[model samples]
Every structure is written in structure tokens, then in C-alpha cells.
Target: MNKKIGLWDLVFMNVSALFGIRWIAKSTASSFGLGLGAIPAWFIFAFIFFVPASLICAELASTYPRDGGLYEWVKEAYGEKSGFMVSWLNWTSKLFWYSSFLTFLMVNVAYVLGKPELAGNKIFVLVCSLVIFWVLSAISTKGMSFAKIFTNIGALGSTVPTILLIAMAFIAVIAFGYKPASTYTVSTLMPKLNMDSLVAISAVMFGLSGAETTANFVTEMDKPEVTFPKAIMISAALVAGLYVLGSIAITMIVPTDQITASEGVLVALDQVAVALGIGHWFIRIVAFGIALSVFGAIILYIASPIKMLFGSVKKGVFSDSFTKVNDHNIPVKAVYLQAIIVSAILLITTLLPSVDAIYNVLVTMTALTALFPYVLLFKSYIKLRKTRPNEKRPYEMSKNNGKAIAIANMVLIVCIIGIVCSAAPVMPSLGENIWYEVQMIGGGLIVIFAGLLIWKRFTKRTGFKESS
Candidate 1:
């Protein structure tokens, strides 16, 4: 197997993973709260939150440099049990996100086909989404080469359309002397801290989240200690700039209050095309690109966690079945298993009346799943500083370990607050009762703890150990 992934390949994967179609989904959603003003805030948050987090992860990746990424870092700093929980949470979160991506893709396709009424038809969406998922899962099982091709194509397919849309919007503004939808103001730029505003802000942060996925590629790089951090910094900056400009362009054409999660960006693009007297051809192309982007993201969604699962199983956290890779060096069974779980989640969305509710629940669940790893990750960072003081780290937060820990702690606290506030009630009419929201959030927590307990018991009974 070719274990070495090149620097350019690393950039593609990181860019693919970081921006993907979800960033667009997020930028589209941001219209609900900050409108055009949210663009700069999104950029600011990315630098403030994502950059430092990436640096911390880069230090960890350099010190460890393993396939399972955060899972390995936690295990090295903590122990087997904590590592198992972290790995499981990371894996499951990816699965939840996979379903979300599939939903997004299906919804967009339905709209582009002039079947807007079918957009909320969960049965149709779920069925179509499952078909796409299985096809991508099959290609993923063929190996990383096929997967990389899709990721690269998907990355370009999605990004180029966004860049075109931004360019077109700029031309329209200059040619027609059109003003922005909302006046840019300092007060308008800052995120609101109330329940309604916090939920919207949390959605914006979701776009900036997930940098740790890039750390998983460290083992494949020739000199990961040097190259990995460079890729992360470059990728984060590029993604943040794209997000800010894209959000600004879309909101410039559409009123924020009129934006719906489902049709915001498309509506903006359609209006821009009309205003420019260019017809709907550009909008159609944009829709196709968005569809391809979501499809590509779904492909990576299946591929990434399966790779992580295979690594974790090899490390003894999961069953041997997960370690069984085909002649292509792909975990066929693991990929299918992931697809099945995602399909099940998609199927359940059909029964739920509110697709937004489903989206919110899935988003909250993803944040919850992601939080477990960050908790262990911060703990791991502290422990590694003290326990493995002699280890050569290519990068460190600071010479003072306590100061690093304090900053990491602060980031963790912010993450926790974001997660909690995400689950908090937002609007009174849209089933945003606090108690109901808590039950959903609480239920997700219960499932996570249950999974942890089950893994712990299984490990004990099976005599699983670090050396195994």
C-alpha cells in the first residue's frame, strides 16, 4: 500500500474536508441572524477559534503522528478507556454528519429538478439519499485513489461555483450601483448572545468547526511535523476568506429576514442573475455545482470515518471485522456499516414533521459527539505536556505549559457553551420549548454514555488491552 500522501494531496484533502458543501450550507444559513454582517464575524470566528485549535492539534500531531489522529493523542495522554470513548464519539459524529450531508444533497437536487414541493417529502429524500450513499460507499470501498478523485472533483465543483457567484454578484453591484441588502455596521457584525441569536451563531460556528480531521493525514505525509501545520494554516485561511466573501455576496442580494434555511443561497443567486439580465442559466449551473459539492462531501463523509474505524479496530478498540480491508486496502464492511447507520437516520427524518427540527437535532447531536473528543483532547494536551516532557514537539502552544492549558481550557469552555446554547430553545412557535429541547439534548447524551459503557464492558470481557 502507498502510505505516503503528498503535500498537494494533503492540501486537497484538508480543503475538501474543511470547506466542502457544508460551508455553503452554513453561509446560506447565516442569513437568518447576521445577514451580510455575519460574513466578517464568520471570518473573525474562524481565525479566533479555528486557527489556535489547529495549532494545538498540529503540536499533538507532530508529537504522535498516527492514523487514528485525535484517538491516538487521547490514548497517549490518557489511557485505553478514555481513548475508546473519544474514538467512538468521533466516529459516530462523522456518521451523523454524513446523514446531514446526504439530506442537504437530496434537498438541493429536488429543488433544482423544479420539484420544490417534494423538498420536504422525507420519504422521497431518504430513498434518493440512500441510493447516493450506497453508490459513494461502493466507490470508497474501491480504495483511496477513487476517493481522492471524487474529493478533488467535488472540491473544485463546489468552490468554483461559489467563486463564480461571488464574482457575478460583484459585477452586478458595480454595474448597477446596487447597495448591500443591509448596511454594514459594527453592532450588526457582532453575534447576538440571546437564545435566538446564540442558536444562529452556533450554526455559524459549525461551519468553522472540524479542523482535527486534517490531523489524521499526518501519518501519510513525508515530514508531517513541518508540512501538516503549514497545510492547516493555509487551508483555514483560504476557507475563512471564501466563507466571508460568499456570505456577503449572497446576503447583498437577499433580505436576511426572508431567508429560509432551505432556499436562501439559491434564491440569492436567482435574484442576482435576474438583476444582471443574465437569465437563470447561471443559477442552474450554481445549483448543479452545489449538488455535486454535497455529493462529493457525502463521499468523503463515508470514506473518512471508515478509515478511522479501521485504524481504531487495528488498535483494539473495535472488533476484528472492522479491520478487514479488501484487496484495494479499503474497509468494505466498515464503509457499508456506516452507510447503513446513516440511511437509518435519514429514514427516521421522514417521520419527523419538521425538517428544520431534524436538522437542528442532527446538528446538536453532532456538536455533542464532537464535544467528547475535545474534552479528552484538552485533557490529553495537559497530560502530554507533563508526562511526555522529553518528547520532541515541532510546535508548542507556549513555553509555559500552564498558560497553554488555560487557553485550551478556555476554548473547551467556549465549545461547551456553544453546544449547550445550541440545544437551548430558540423560537416559541417552532417547537422551541426549553424542556422539549432538553429532552432531545439529554437523550443524545444518554446514547453517548451508553455507548461508552458498552465499549468499556466489551473491552473488559474480551480482555482488550493496549498491547493487543
Candidate 2:
């Protein structure tokens, strides 16, 4: 409806969603392997996971090019039940993921205030998390013109700080003669296919991910078929490059054990500044940038999928009143409704053992729930190829070569493995508190399956039977 999302708009939107170099901190901190050992997982997952997923999303969005891009794509292939299921998982994933990023923002704020330990302060975290979520959520209520500003901020905010950090790391290496803690050899860079390696690879699903979701805004794009695929590849390449380079930068300074999963990037930046003989002020500056970048990311997650889900309302499945847009053409009801849901999740998270536990649990559950929807996306790609043989695909993978479907199936397997591995704890540090993993896997499923009843009730209320 709103064509404000041009090519560059989609580009930065991808930047906001996919190019979170903060994930370098998250990935290197995860089971992705120790330090530089994690680098190989990037390439491995990129080929087997990200590349296929990106192709799938690009073609889906290009062919469908509708208001609810991914939802419409899946529905065309498998019907409404299938479509709503994946959309709901994606929406829920963001719901939990938002709280985690808010926690990231709160902790980074604590670092700026020179009380890095305040990240553990429950009241501070709760209040800051709620305040930040609501404020950004409210700003997002204004629709695309306003949302674009934050996304532009997201592009600049995320990239600039990461570039600076990489530069500092290179300076640390050359000027200070700081040798990196890990060395790169075939043994270290070559991936091991054990269970730990499997779990670690899933981190890529979380990091250097979400380029596919740009399809959510396909309808808003000026020339979506042409723009969407190009933006996905370009943004993903830049995002991936920054991720590996940033990983090298951070690992050059902090040892594997020193890198905490949550706020390791901030800590690494601080250590790098000290090592470089720069004042601590650089840490504060970058911390501010981290806060902005995380907020930029949070805004994109909150705005898009909720709008995608609002298509359910337009279909007469949700109350028509729920689809009300503001003067800015933004879905006002969905924006506030998602804020309410995120608040409830943050409230539920308080029951966890500690602040760190809360952050870890929410993030783990977020990552876990995100995969099911991804698996659905891959399947939708295969199904669409069969169901719509002549669907004017702007970005079709030449299936005549016979290699495309094989690669796509590999992507499907990668998604399934991530979901299976998600059932177990990805982080060993949390093994002492095994309940966190239980809550993550158990809790995430309850939310997803519950969507079935909701979808059923909506269809029933409308007296609308989905076509078989």
C-alpha cells in the first residue's frame, strides 16, 4: 500500500535486520567453536544454509510481491494452515528476540554509564527494557517514512561502529604487535561435524541471517522483483564480510573464555581501546553506537512481521478493527499489540534465575523458534516450483541444471538440524541450569502450537473454510 520502500530502503532494511555485527560477538561466544575456530562455520553454513535460503526468499517475494510476502508465498503453495503456522513462528521468534536485544541494549547502556555490572540489576534492566521497547514501538507506529529514518540509522549505526572496531583491531595487531589468541589453519578453520559443531552452526541461523525476511516489505517496494533480490545478495555479502572481519577483530583482542555471549562486543571494544592507548571515551562512543544499532534492529523486527501478520485481519480471519492503520498508513493496532505481547514476555522472563539467565533463556528460545518457520520457507520454495511452473520468477534458480533443487534440499536439512539442535542447549555455560533449556524448548513449542487453536478459531469465526 505504501510504496515508500524503494531499493535503498530495502537495502537498509536488510542492513537493519541482517547486518548485525553485534552477532559477531554473539556467534564467537556461542558453541560455533572456540575463537577463530568459528570462522569455518560461516562458510559452511553460508553455502549449505544461507545461500539457498536467500535464493528461496528472493524468488518467493518476487513471484508473490504481495502485502504479506512470505505468508502469501507459503499459502499459494500449501494453503492457509501452512502459511499461518510459519508466519506465527516468525512473529513469535521476533517477540522473544526483541526482549533479548532490549537486554543487549540495556547492558550496553550500563557499560556506557561505567557500571557494566548494572546489567544484572533487575529493576534497571526491566525498566530500561520496557522503556526502550515502548519508545521504539511507538515511533514505529508512524509507518514507513519514520521507520525508514531508524533503518537508515540502523545502517549507519551498525556499520560505522563495526568498521571502527575492525580498524582498531588491525591497529592493535600491527602497531601494538598484538598476536591474535587463535591461529587459522585448516585444522582450526575446517569444521568438525560433531553435535557441538552442529549446535554452533545454528548460530549462523541467528547471525548473518534475516536477509530473506526483506520479502516482508515486498509490497511496499517500488520495483520489488528487481530490487528485492539484488538487495538481498548485496546486503548479505556486506553483512557476511563485516561479520567475519569483525570476528577477526574481536578475537584478536579477547580470548575465547573472556568473550561473554551477551555483551562481549562491548567488552572487546573496551579492551581494544585500552590496548591501543586510546582513552576510555572511545568505549563510551561505541557503546552509544551499539545502543542505536540495537534499537535500529529492534525497530525493524517489531514493524515488519506484525504488518505481515495483519494480513490475517484483511482476510476476515482477524477482526477488521485490528487492521486499522494510522494516518501514516502504518498498522497502528498491530504495533501496539506486539508491544503488549513483548511486555508480557519480558514479565515472564523475570521468573528466570538471574538477569544473565533471563537474557540467555529468552535469546535461546528466540533462536529456537525462528528455525521452524525457516524450514517452512525452504519447503515452500520446492512446493512453489511444482505448483506454479510459469510464475514469472525474476530470481529463479535454473532448476533445469538439476543442481538447484539438490542445494535447496540441503538448505532444508540445515534448517531441520538447527531446529533439532535447538532442542538441546546451544550454550554449555547454561548446562548447570538445565531448566533454562527445558523452558526454552518446552516454552517455545507451547507458543507455536497454540497458534493452531487461534488460527482455527479465526477461520471458524469468519465461517470461512480454507480451500483444500
Clashes of each: 0, 0
Model 2 stretches astray by more than 4 angstroms: 1-16, 30-34, 138-144, 190-197, 214-236, 299-301, 312-314, 325-336, 390-392, 426-434
In the range 101-165, model 2's lDDT, one tens digit per residue, is 89888988988888888977878998889988898888888765644566567677778888988
Error of 1 at 26 (Å): 3.3
Best-matching candidate per lDDT? 2
TM-score of each: 0.86, 0.86
Tens digits of lDDT, candidate 1, 422-445: 666654556546544654477567
lDDT of each: 0.68, 0.72
List ranges where model 1 is wrong by over 4 Å: 1-14, 21-37, 138-144, 216-234, 313-323, 326-333, 430-440, 463-468
Give the CA lDDT, 0 to 100, for residue 37 in model 1.
Answer: 50
User: Predicted candidate 2: what Cα RMSD to the true structure?
Assistant: 3.7
